[model samples]
Target: MSKSSHRDPLSDTQLRVKALESVLLEKGVVKQETLDAIIDNYENKVGPHIGASVVAKAWTDPDFKSRLLENASDTLAEMGLSGIEGTHVEVKENTAELHNMVVCTLCSCYPWTLLGLPPTWYKSTPYRARAVRDPRGILAEFGVKMSENVEVRVWDSNAEIRYLVLPIRPAGSEGLGEDELAELVTRDSMIGTAVVEMN
Candidate 1:
């Protein structure tokens, strides 16, 4: 077989990305070590679990919850969770009457260290527009039917700051431990797309 036939197939976009990466590496614009570190950070070191831990702690500890609400950056730093994309973080709490959701109207400026990579929908133009324009509709589509009496607040994340939603603890979960509570926290809940359910 010829070299072309032997080569693995790659999509046009993938090939372009690989070509650009090769050119950058050849030009010394980026170091292999840096690239490896970034991949490793996203693949292993970072994820929604980090944010879930903080949420669990907040759920179990009143003081921690207060600190998280009052100063999320400082509180996250205390847990050694501070880094790029997390320098300026804000935590919004969900209560009986108040509901909060976060969206990046400009771009997907998310808390990468806490939430890993942003979801494809989060970066889409439709989501960016609808999140601010019709948050209740979006929530309803996600199966969250908010009562008419409940207030809905939509937060726009930007380059300067990112928002994390502190979803209300599920009923019958009061007896759960921190780790168990963390298990209950989902990435969508933190993004305010879905509420945490015990089941």
Candidate 2:
């Protein structure tokens, strides 16, 4: 028989689990339960909250915002978030001169450090394809109407650099603290589908 004929017939999920198990077994370092716990801890407790903090700090500190604009990965490390996507991150700012939007296009390649697991819409194939072609129309469907003059530039995230949107700070937040400001920075804002509005 040929080498291909001798291969196993496991499904994709089964193959992934078997591959992970093989690696863990080879390492002989930790139990499956322990590895599961580590994954759970990072996903639930560490990643999203760290990202929120960074957004909050940027809202409150102009200097930090400058640094983030210059070198996002290094600025993120200054806030104790390193090793995210191999120390590489890119910050895209949304402005009237040039609005920025992000979509995985291929898959949900997100910056989990500042924004946890991606939302359902982000992973949808429709969003990936439509976001780049008609950004303003997509945003309008999400109830965001933009001026006709504002140009929208959609970014497709790949294996190398992850993209995050720096939303324009809302008005009437002149006296808000960092924690309060962070609450305004929602996932939609980062995705450039919704703008934060102050009451």
TM-score of every model? 0.91, 0.80
Weakest lDDT window of 10 consecutive positions for candidate 1: 3-12
lDDT of each: 0.91, 0.78
lDDT of 1 by residue, 47-129 (tens): 99999988999999999899999999998987888888888899999999999999999878898878988889989999999
In candidate 2, position 151 carries an lDDT of: 80
Please, what are the lDDT tens digits per residue for candidate 2 over residues 108-128?
888776776688889999999
Worst 10 residues of 2 by lDDT: 45-54
The segments of candidate 2 whose C-alpha lies over 4 angstroms from its true place after superposition are: 1-30
- Model 2, residue 11: distance off in Å is 8.2
